[model samples]
Target: MDSNKRRHVGHRRDNTVLPLAAGVAVVAASCLTLFVKALLKRNSKPTQKQGKGREGGSAPKSPGAGAYVRGMREREYVRLIPDVEMLSLQSLLRRIQKARGWQFRDDAARDQAWARVLATAQSAAGGAWPLDFTPNDVTPEQLQALCDAVEAEFLGGLLAEQVRRAGRPRIRVVLGVDPRDPYSWLSGLHEDNTIFVNSNRWREEVSQDNPLVFEGALCRSKLEALAHTLGHELTHAVVLNFFPAMDASSPAYTPDDKHGPVFMWLNRRLFGHVGHASKRLFNT
Candidate 1:
């Protein structure tokens, strides 16, 4: 695919924070902490009731089971765990106040939070983990593969559940660098599934190095952030594709509620986070 049409170039801003970069910091800290505990919980022997569902190691029941007809027979589900960076425990706690829309509120019990998190981990197990990349730069082939993985992990699964779909929800992703825009990335949906990430910033992160004490740790964080970006913009693209009617093309197009209950449900279905399933429940 041609690089320009496949990806977008994000305009640079002096101080605006992009969701892919800022949001993952909060998400990886909170959710991944809970995920470790979940792994332990999963390890502790399974009971008869829990084992019933996994009696045959079968694929989970499809939400769109009966309605979906054959179009593209690519049923290989590839789950990706984006290489989002980790935030300090203290940082996560501090950001908790800003998480106004969390699935469970601050006053809610910790066990409740744990339960929801465990469910997410279980759902993600069948999915594939994301490919690790150097912090410095991504080759054209790598960029294309990243886009394909995003489709398989997030968009493809949702597409499979649809009843009346044409050939398939066409999508692709590419990269771009725009100086002056603080945003890390943007999704172009009018034509195809293309994600334009800030190349300048991406390169900066790649060339950036921390102290000797914290070498690879920071690199891992950069990868996490990128993966989160893929998961995110791909989700947005799928929603836009599935319900273009929800988009406002009129003069008053700005006045619409695309991020309502339906959008949340879509996230839950695709990323396995129902209600408000993101690591960063809200933007601070």
Candidate 2:
């Protein structure tokens, strides 16, 4: 009887230990399989072109501009410009005063007041117009023309530089206003994307009574305002190409959210004091 009892106890112990051991082994094997699968997935994925270097990895080398240009072709690209409505000097002054929250007695008085504002603001801002910058004067039937010229001359030059650096892709500019909202303004995608500029804000902020104040500098002149807007939009375009992956991953990507150190670095690199000055002047 004593021997039988000892044998029964031993059998029970073995059964319990064997199942527990088997379960632990199965769990360990499952965990190992999952880890191996994840490792393989990570290794098999293609790497991005730019961020890898900063992330402690190297990119595959390709031929010169030919290869770079070929790679760009796979990406989509577009440019957008909002249309402008030409207003008479009287109409323009009234619109400007309204946008600025300035009270004027009449249209004629507003026009005279705006003229003085423009001259004084331009002198204060300290830059040559039409060369260092271009201004769009609000005149009947000429607003669109001015916008076109700026897009072609100023923005065109900036885009051309980008194309030379990154190689050209399909680019187009969309034009119009957001009917539902009046306070809308220009925006751009840093990579192949569109730029939106608000005509109303441009006119209002560039006015004498209500000059757009940025970084302690005032943008009163039309040219200065245009330059400021162009610089901002161009920065967006450049970053879109240089840091495509950053956009894809970050949830902080928005019109108001600054693109962090990358944007500051590029701005400092490209424009130097002028970029600094513009950033100051526009408060961007």
Candidate 3:
């Protein structure tokens, strides 16, 4: 009986050690991460801090979604469904950021700045680049929410309303990190109505260019970037009645047509900005 008790205690100790060891590993990892972060900050340029927290869900009543989700709807808009957690989102972000050297900051200001890098880049391309900071913590669900809000609020009055209502040809935005390719801004899977936005490329472009306009304007800029991208994609998703139909020999319409003159004219009339569709459309 005494021998049996001794063996059981040893087994219990063995089980306890695994959790304890795992806990220790997590703590050590966190400490190391913090240390590295501090070292980087110390060596980096002197940047201002932004301590503001993100506001409520994607509600029209909620304040500026970095001016991305704006324009008065006939009635109040509410999101009935709560955001859902992405599948292994952390692991995915980690891999993308790791490969691209995308640095993150706990300092609200710094994180906000980092997040807005994409917005600044989009703005530098010029479309009244509004001063708004969009956060980096956008979940897949929130992204969808923003899209839905944009569709409802901005595109509702446009000719695209019919396409928006049918909803069969859906549009999707996903976060992908590919270091080897520069097709990072936005790629469309038209067959299935999907758009892939490369997070890695965005980070690389913004970080390298560093078009950060203001000290505390991270979230605003981030949302502006997303809003512009959403608008660009929405244009692709829906065909305006005015859109010239593709034909056998009328001069092959290149993918660049989406950001071409006609599209920009319609874009300005509809949602206010032509976005960074192309260099030619930048100032116009």
Please provide, for model 3 over 1-284, each residue's C-alpha lDDT reduced to its tens digit, 9 standing for 90 to 100: 89999999999999999999999999999999999999998868543342211121232222222222222221211221112211122233344234333233224433443344334433423232333422254456655555655554444433234445655555666666433343534433243455666654344222213442221122133454455566556655544322224211111112244443223323433344423343211110
Better of 1 and 2 by TM-score: 1
Clashes of each: 18, 12, 11
TM-score of 1: 0.36
lDDT of 1 at 278: 26
Name the TM-score of candidate 2. Answer: 0.36
Best by lDDT: 3
RMSD for each model, in Å, please? 34.5, 19.1, 23.9
True-vs-predicted CA distance for residue 281, candidate 1, Å: 13
Each model's lDDT comes to 0.38, 0.40, 0.41
TM-score per prediction, in order, is 0.36, 0.36, 0.38
Judged by TM-score, which candidate is best?
3
Superposed on all Cα atoms, model 1 deviates from the true structure by an RMSD in Å of 34.5
What ranges in model 3 sit over 4 Å off? Answer: 1-137, 157-161, 164-167, 177-189, 204-220, 240-257, 280-284
Pick out the ten consecutive residues of candidate 2 with the lowest summed lDDT. Answer: 76-85
